[model samples]
Target: MTGERGRGRVQAVAGVVLLAWVVLFAAFVEVGNPLVLLATAVSGGLVCACAVAGGVVTMRLTDAETAARLRHVFVVLEGTAMAIFYLFYGFAFSVEPVGRPGDFAVVVLLVLSVPALGALTLVLWRSYAVHKIVVDAFGPLVPDSGAGVPVQRIRVLGTVLVTVGLALAVSAMTVALVTPMYRPVLLTVGLFVTLSPVVLGVSLTRVTDVYSARRRNVGNYVIVLAASGFAVSEFASGAGVAGVLFGALVFGAVVLLVIAILVVREFTGEWDRPWREPRGRKVSP
Candidate 1:
């Protein structure tokens, strides 16, 4: 479709611009004593830009349901690429006893290639499963609109995954906080756990365009608060206990606030009415 092609073009241009920015920034920092923190921040910005571009491209090229399923894949790839690139650069330039070429190659391949492949596979599987669900559940209601029908199911599943992943990631962070110094096992597990929530959270946000805008806004607020608190906690003393506790409190408060808002909206007719439509109606998916 012409619309899809236009969106793809926009995404490609945005992605190119972001990649260029990242290269320029990295080069600028290379002249100075490159700090790991600076590298990470810059890399993170690039990753975010890439994620947005990927989402836009996916949304334009695929159906809404397919895009929802692919959201996690794109997020994971962007994050993994950013992390691997930043770490490689930092370790090579800053850390003493520079890693061997083979070792660096192996690490880069594992971090970038494996995760990219895994995410792509997972997206394909989820998409197929969502397609089947839509065909079975809403085929009669909207005979030709396969894409819209699967969107709701995708959203529900994505939200559930994100919530579960966040809980696990929090648990992992608790362990790391208790341990203080980074053990290889704990660090690796913590990183994976953290990434899980990130990937799933992005997917949830993408699917939310179909749902309650209020819920989406609340969720975004919670995510930002939680992320900022967690980042701040890393700099705290006392093994970051105080920071962790503060972050946890914030997260809990946000969760409670979101629930309250949802409850009030439900009772006050502020909630969207799509869920109330007849089961067989051709409501927005």
Candidate 2:
């Protein structure tokens, strides 16, 4: 309980800090329009709300498992909020020379908001179902199998991401092939995005069986890579052709950090055991 409280405090602090940073960033950009800044602030506030909500749920819940699932819900919410904020702002910066920021913001908001809405709906529906089941059960809902399990929910999310990413990647590649101004770096970005989801889906699927520690570690690394790719891609898009090398450099640094963390964890014996105790069985100490 003490640990939970500490984590919650940390999340609260993070939310405050993030809100501050967003306001500072908007001021730094010298955005002339008050509405643009207001929109940015609202997005930041939504993220802060998500972060604070996650911590509150974590602290308030007695059941660790349900709390864990709820945390995932808030995490998705935070990501979705931030993604929409970034996509709109990033596209605004990336728009063609003659394009107005107002027009770009409107178009990008519509484009990004649709998928975010669908993703949020799925997350909330699944989370509600899980909460209902767990609450109605006589004891802790030990998810040994089936779609009710948290792992199963993750797999479903992964599957959806992979399917959508693959389709988008294919379409992007087709356009790149026929277009004279196509950038290879953009294609690489699409491939990285697609690969991350595919790797995550495969890794999580494997974990459903024995839940190997190494497999989990690898999955974590893939998640880091995916996040790095996303951040880099957004920056690259905004920076134009000049950002290709910069994005690669940033990504390479992230990869090295992930590798170093893996090595440290391995040496500390963190990955020397199963991720979870075997179902319906016990390990002798």
Model 1 stretches astray by more than 4 angstroms: 29-33, 45-49, 52-221, 224-285
For each candidate, the alpha-carbon lDDT, in order, equals: 0.40, 0.45
**Number of clashing residue pairs, candidate 2:** 0
- Pairs with backbone N, CA or C atoms under 3 Å apart (clashes), candidate 1: none
Off by over 4 Å in 2: 1-14, 28-46, 55-162, 202-208, 212-218, 221-285
Give the per-residue lDDT digits (tens) of candidate 1, residues 1-285: 345445546555555554555455445432222343244435444443453455354545445455444544543444344333333333223311123321223333233333333333333333333334334434422232223535455455446556765665666566565755443444453444344445644544454233332234333433433343323333321234543453343334333333323322222222222344225643222
Can you give the TM-score per candidate against the true fold? 0.35, 0.46
> What is the TM-score of candidate 2?
0.46
lDDT of 2 by residue, 196-284 (tens): 54555454454442234223554355354445444444445444444544444443333333333333232222323333454775322
